[model samples]
Target: MEPCPECGASMDPRSCDELFHALLALDHSRQAPWGPLHGVSVSCFLLQHPSRLPADDGAMAWALLHTYLEGGLDEVNQLVGQARRDNSHRVKGGPLRVVRDAPLPHRDASRSRFSVTIQDVAVDGTFPSSAFTERVKAWAAATVDAWSCGT
Candidate 1:
């Protein structure tokens, strides 16, 4: 398989999508320790794949990621309900929307240019709730760090 142009992970082998879907699956266990961090995981994934996002959604992803960067989980937790209510479609526990309001043809950025991706973290396999939660935060933090470098 070829490396993903955005995150540099191998494609078709379920690299990024695997991690994202696993995090998305956490909706059934929102009461679990890793539940609340789903937004972070979602934002990180969307931000890494800029081409899939429209211009407006790209801005939303950046703002959402920035919120996690500045306020941590407590702040991100505050935005979760609003994101869900913004659209009828479910994103599991992800931030904002997984399905964009606009098409990707007029996107703001074609490339993500991220320094960090799911590849940068130990996201494979299973983990205890607390450890899984930590990895989500770590992935988000790494995404923010990439933004900080203006990538």
Candidate 2:
């Protein structure tokens, strides 16, 4: 479905969910080993910040459930590292933490902050702090993409 041309707001959750599911299903059909993304759940929210206001900040986020046959946590750790490095160059506040987490992502009551907790589904163990920060970065990017279609 097309987004709102004026404000770019597509306030339909079903449409967004269907689009994401369809994309994942089609992609999985061609790639047999694409198990990193087992399932995903997405929801949208309006971003409101008093200090830094976004131009058109309707945000969409996804809860990605992933599974890896071999070295799952290891791979997530690597991705997290990359995310942290990338985010550092963008934000001036310092750095964000990304790690293997358990609790689902959530927005703070104040609506000023949010977080995504990626639990290590692997049997190995919890991931390191430095590595976890990277995951946060990746998740943020993905969330932004899923929300606005880069508009």
Candidate 3:
């Protein structure tokens, strides 16, 4: 196995192929909404280029994830705003707020690798422990499987 230049994640030659297929699956599947995994996929695609690594993979991943989440929040906020304009009484929450802890980026230069953990997520000031968590996990698992199976 070789280390990915950008994130330093150890990857076999097949890893890139796997990543490519994963991206394709995400593109095709309606079940996979635009979110963290999309960000990760884009980052991986950019960083895993054979020619050069664009930036630290781990940092890029977190940055993309943050961007994706923020974009989602913006969409939700827009929807809520639209709802308020349409019918003031129909909207339940004034606005949905999403909050999450900063991702912790860990890297080992010697191994040319990096990883991150998303600590928590909250929607409307409440932890949706199951739904949100499960979505992320399922997306990640699917991504891994997509690549591992060489599909």
Q: Each model's C-alpha lDDT?
A: 0.60, 0.32, 0.39
Score residue 136 of candidate 2 by CA lDDT.
33
Higher lDDT: candidate 1 or 3?
1
Error of 3 at 143 (Å): 17
lDDT of 2 by residue, 57-89 (tens): 211112222211123435654644555675676
List candidate 2 stretches off by more than 4 Å. 1-14, 27-35, 38-74, 77-151
Model 2, global lDDT: 0.32
Candidate 1, poorest ten consecutive residues by summed lDDT: 98-107
lDDT of 1 by residue, 74-139 (tens): 666665556557654643553445332322223433344555566554344343454666666667
Better of 1 and 3 by TM-score: 1
> What ranking of all candidate models by lDDT puts the best one first?
1, 3, 2
Model 3, range 78-139, lDDT digits (tens) per residue?
Answer: 44454346455565665422233334233322222223212111222222334654544433
Error of 2 at 87 (Å): 32
Candidate 3 runs further than 4 Å off: 33-40, 43-64, 69-113, 116-151
All candidates' TM-scores? 0.64, 0.26, 0.33
**Full-model lDDT, candidate 3:** 0.39
